[model samples]
Target: MTTSVPPADRRVPEAVHRRRWAILGVLMLSLLIVVLDNSILNVAIKTISTPAPTGLGATQSELEWAINAYTLVFAGLLFTAGLLGDRLGRKKVLLAGLAVFGIGSALAAESGSPVQLIVFRAVMGLGAAFVMPATLAVLMNVFERDEQPKAIGIWAGGVGLAIAIGPITGGILLDHFWWGSVFLINVPIVLLALVLMFWLVPDSRDPNPGRVDAVGVVLSVIGLVLLVYGIIKGGQLADFTDVKVLATIAAGLVVLAGFVVFEKRSDHPSIDVTYFKNKVFSAAIAAIALVFFALMGVTFFSVFYTQSVRGYSPLQTGLLMLPLAAAQIIFAPRARLVVDRFGNRATCTAGLLIIAAMLAAFAVLDTDTPIWLLEVIFFLMGTGMAHIMTPTSVVIMQALPREKAGSASALSNTFRQVGGALGIAVLGSVLSTAYRSGIEDKLSSVPAGLRHTAGESIEATLGVAAKLGPQGKALVGPANDAFLHAMHVTALCGAGVALVGAVVVAVFLPGRTPDAQEGKEEADLVPVAEH
Candidate 1:
């Protein structure tokens, strides 16, 4: 019902324009909670794996499901959520999302079983699906095109802030309170965000949102669910070549292909699939996905390496991750300057290579590797990520017209979530297979009946060792060694993935030019209808 730039260049609403900064702050607050929840959960993984009263005693696979359930659902519904935000109203969708997120947080806090936790996590993901895209959409509508990059830089910085805070906060909660407190803490933050949003945030929506692509939505979700199930199952069983796994994975690909075909053929597609024809746009999306694939996988296993293999407590592990977050906070906002000088291709490729180097560095780390060296790797990794996320994001968002802001945001995030989820599943599988093979012979002293269980994961092996007392202590060293080997294999795999991403952006993203820079500067001089 309102436009910041009208046909005659009418004066922008003073209320909307004046409150832009405040609205940004509120949007960042919302973003922080969604990001914080996951980062906090990372530190709690080891705790949640412990038995009974103190923890949930969930298996490594179960812990992965808990995390992936959120990601899968978030990825699955994000496009739909974005469409709804564009159609219904960003402000309304945001409020609804925050409320659902709060309720889901409460439910997750009270979950009595791993199954319960996974389900509630999916619910949280559903809410998060709405929250993530809507926040970006509202920001796009409120900020002037010329200032959008700066605003987005700050927005990306908010993620870094959450990464810095989530772990330490979770650590403090775990040290003093229950594991659930990590999630329970979201309640008050959600409440505060809701109140601020109601007062400061303005509503905006596309005046003519087309009809929903119901069939396409269903196909995407089903395909994703099947693919992820297949991957997770293969990991859980340590047998990817199994008939069931192959069939499920193939079916998922087929369904996804069908969805794409239907969308291309449909009159009103959910996404303008043709945007991918732009080499720069497609390349940018690939960059986002590949970077997250590597980052999330590394993050998933780092906690275990620090806490389980190196004997750091949850708090210590949380503190250890600080260098990573600090580097992001320091570098993310300033990355645009680097891009201005280097261009997107050069900047992103350099960042990915740095990340790859850091990941490969993990291959040499051992139980006694100096802690400071680990910190350096974390810092470098973060520095790489800070650079990669910003410019790639700008490319993806700018590639689409302003009206499709919600869809653009959704597409970027969807690939990110999907990439991250697949990374965890695939890399986790590699870790499992490698560890099991390394430690299988060592388990010969154990009874045949329990050998499979002991070989399942480091956590499981340790649990069995503890039950055997002195005998168990003997298994501890071997378990650590096995995990180290697995980490080496997994880290190398991640490094390879990052290297692939580097090649991708280097090949496809455009180099710097005077015209491109001038266009960016003059973006706000006039508004044009894209279609």
Candidate 2:
């Protein structure tokens, strides 16, 4: 009540500040678990769906639900979670997230039915919503302005590492244990992260937090869920013109538009409507979205190409895919240097161009393509992605006010998740359509029943081929050729998308002219309050 402390004296101790790096480790570990969870389940899906002592006899739709449930819930709740973190406390929300995730993992491993597993996965996604945004928000709060790009580089690299390791890890676990072991692995990692985070991470919250935007939350959740549901359904049915699909998408878009208008008019908006006016911020978001779109599309085909076409075991396929992740790990940390020397606009454009070229290269792949050549393509693709992801993320975060870090992080990640989902839906539909047409044409001489069964998927085609004895041998050549044709078409489409993103990055992303950018940074680097 008596004395006023100096501003410098009010800042947290240097020792406490120095612990930020350690805190980042915990944050990365949390991020790794979530990222790994997304892909690890892919390897375990067949095992979980089979009928046996170790399996649940899940229907095809139920298996799809197991994956979609997690994605839908995660995407739906990200903004709300971010808002809660900023208003309550990031560390508090993060701890709660970790607890939920660990518990969900434990329960999921013990689940006896597909429905139970899907429900638990949704719970895990809710935890992920809290954890993902908090990680980035905390990183921005703790790191100095100059150091942020490097920190983000590491964080992005960790995601790349998770992508590479998840399938391999899942395959190993499934080989030696029950399919549930893949889910169980998350528990120990979550426990370790919880202990480290509690000890090292500092708590931070908005000093003048506003009231929760309940209406905005409801609108966002409903709109996103409906939109994703439509997309997933369209992909599954390969029918965008279906009445249900069209109606749901239309309704979701209308609701989302209403949400934007409401936010702009609200006094205590969940997200600052004006932030989108920053060209760099908007462009960075677009860049990240498109990068993921192209990456996911290619990845969907690559997995099929390796396992279904090349006849690699799950472990071998995972090992073969390592070049992509290894390149990102090696190059991502150095991306900041490139951005510093060049600029975000230039670096991102270059990266996108590289990605476009690689995707185009992938279009020409056939059954006869050399494994080494595929490895090189994957490596270059990862290198391009590393260049794009880290710099764009840094640019997006830097453009926002420090107090809005959580919301900004959530916005960034939400766009990424949406883009990935759309990629899989749209490109997957393209692949499926082309495969169906080509296989149907090629199987003109095949029995109608066998042809219909084989037309469903490459896996089913091979399975049917095996069952027909010597006559099944005739199906192999046509099926392989048809699948490769579909892959080529999908890759070309992805390349076109990447090229468009490159043009957008080049034209819209602000350049880092030294005087203007440095001045802006200096003006914006006001010290935020520390807990």
lDDT of 2 by residue, 1-531 (tens): 000112232454576678978987888899999999877776566566555565675533455556657766777677677768878898999999989999999999989998998899889988988887777767766776556656766775678778889889987887788888999999999999999999998887766555777787788767876776676566445567999989988988999899899999998775666899998788888888887787666766677788678877666666777888788878877886898779889999999999999989977788878899999998998899889887876677578765555456667677777677667666766776677777877666567876765675565576667777898888898888888988888788888999999998999887775967755774554322100
> After TM-score superposition, what is the CA distance of residue 485 in candidate 2 from its true location, in Å?
1.8
TM-score for each candidate, following the candidate numbering = 0.92, 0.84
Clashing pairs in 2: none
Total clashing pairs for each candidate = 0, 0
Clashing pairs in 1: none
Deviation (Å) of 462 in candidate 1: 0.9
In angstroms, how far off is 159's CA in candidate 1? 1.3
Query: Each prediction's Cα lDDT score?
Result: 0.83, 0.76
